[model samples]
Target: MTKIANVRCQLVDLEPETARSDASQSFVKQETVLVTVETVDGMSGTGYSYTIGTGGTAVVAMLRDHLVDGLLGADARNVEQIWQRMVTGTRATTVGAITSLAMAAIDVALWDLRGQRADEPVWRLAGGAHDRLPLYDTEGGWIHLTCEELVRNALAAKAAGVRGVKVKVGKPSLTEDAERLAAVRDAVGPAFEIMVDANQCFTGAEAARRAHSYESLGIAWFEEPLPADDLAGHVRLAAATTVPIAVGESLYSSLRFAEYVAAGAAGIVQVDAARVGGITPWLKVAHTAESFNVPVAPHFLMELHASLACAVPNGMYVEHIPQLGAISRGGHVIEEGWIRPPESPGIGIDWDLDAIDNLRVA
Candidate 1:
């Protein structure tokens, strides 16, 4: 057994092509806390935790303070035991927030180690349940792009062989939001699947009003129409709108999702592998969501979700955005509308050392 030798982490602040926005702060430079685990046998594994350009230092500190001590010198093969030691072992403080983020890094690293040791791809290790995961173009989300630009972008996705697309629609004015959504729907035609995300940028009444107008457009789903923490609001919106209510990215646990399911708040689940404490808990949430008859449509990290979407029956579309130039190495190739999972062992993607250098921000 290879004993765990060392653990180290870094914060990578990567700039986007332009300022990206919704009803909240708008900017590039997404902050990511990257974790690296090394073993006595010279094998090492890597993982990352995502944040909105802040909380990176805190995430790294949590791993250094709480995780490194318990993780080092342990058997790298005993992944579950180590994870439990770091998570449930600190029940009073470990159930949410920074701790979950820290666990995300450690969990992903272990899976990476397992894949390398077994000499198989992580997707295969996780059991390659399908050949490919479907893709959805998700960048036209109200980042100040015009309706024509939005339509052009949607058409480009179709031209690229993508079948579905999502756009943002919380402009404060319901009329303006409606027109933008309608324009895109008209451009994409009736058969193509178009999803709308409010990014928690509306009131329950506003959500219902906007959703009512959007229903005429044949949208595939309505995502985060209200703040994620507002269960009552979500329940109200879900009840009021004929459009399917979808959410889950802001939620930090499968436990949190349980409330959403019980309240009948969401019909679709958007589990983030990084956000839900990495692949382990994310799968747990997927299973739980399935039991509730809710479909899993993961948020961000398309490369990571490729295998995930393929592996679960209720798994829906994977959000496709090119944030990988920030830390990810080669993993998936988008051919037509399908995103292929990496065939390499453990997570299938590596950090491009050279690209990492260019992305450094003090």
Candidate 2:
């Protein structure tokens, strides 16, 4: 094997002009860390890890001070060792969230390099992957959206061939939440898959009450009904209501995933591509959830997950918000409710460096 050669990282500030809203928060900006790793063989790979908006600086710092230092001269093929070493650094500061975002950026690049080396796509390398992955539109719903507007997006999703549609809930009280779900339910009807996300904006009891109310509407699942770290609350909501809870995007660790799995707190696992350290731990989590018979439905960065979802048998659905289309050189195309996974090697989604650079604020 060629000696591991050079590694570099960059922090990018990509903010949207207008804030896009969801149930719990508004996305006023986006922050991404792009990691590029090069090898002595002249083989190079690209990766992306995300903090979304505010944590880009911290993530960039970890790479400059710790992550890149650890990777220098390390065997590029020893992906596991590199990953473990990064994890070790976690004992002190625990890259849990910060480092994983960094790890993901690097890991994805490495995987892309691997695929290019073999002249094969990532989905093929991961295993025998399907050509398409089912998708559900997240609709980018905000708190200000009227019930009718929420329903309109749901209809749009159905018209787009999306088999499933997810909407925002948690409107300050259970009564309002129920009313919103009711509107979305009526708009889309009983056959179309409907899911609601609280964005972890409610108390355990509030989550439970909302869950109970939506049960009659046949909601597929309740997402992040309680705060991400509220393990006991997760358990409470899972137990108290007939609706199963879904979470993991804001969740930071495999051990935490184990916590939710063991407690039977979450039924649907929504892992993020960049959040859990690129494809490595992301795949690990999918495999882990499979053991518990839980369905894996990934969160944002749908571009990256499109291939991943097809490669894994347990993948349930991909959430589509459509804003990233402007940034991604050639964004994933949504066709008849299924995304045609990128045929390019590695994660397959093109980063559009110029676009990324053009959007850089700092």
TM-score of each: 0.94, 0.94
lDDT of each: 0.81, 0.78
Instruction: Please give the lDDT score at residue 240 for candidate 2.
Output: 85
The sequence of per-residue lDDT tens digits that candidate 1 reaches over residues 1-362 is 48999987877787774557776567556777777789999998887777776677788878877678888899988887887787766577656777778788888888888889999877777756666777898776554888888899999988888978888877868888788888888888999889988888888887888899988889889998888899999988888878899998888877888889888998899988888888788878888888988888898877678877777777778888767665666778789988887778888777887777676552
Span of ten consecutive residues with least summed lDDT in model 1: 17-26
Q: Show where candidate 1 strays beyond 4 Å.
A: 89-92
Best by lDDT: 1
lDDT of 2 at 325: 55
Model 2, 112-137: lDDT tens digits are 87787788788778864467878887
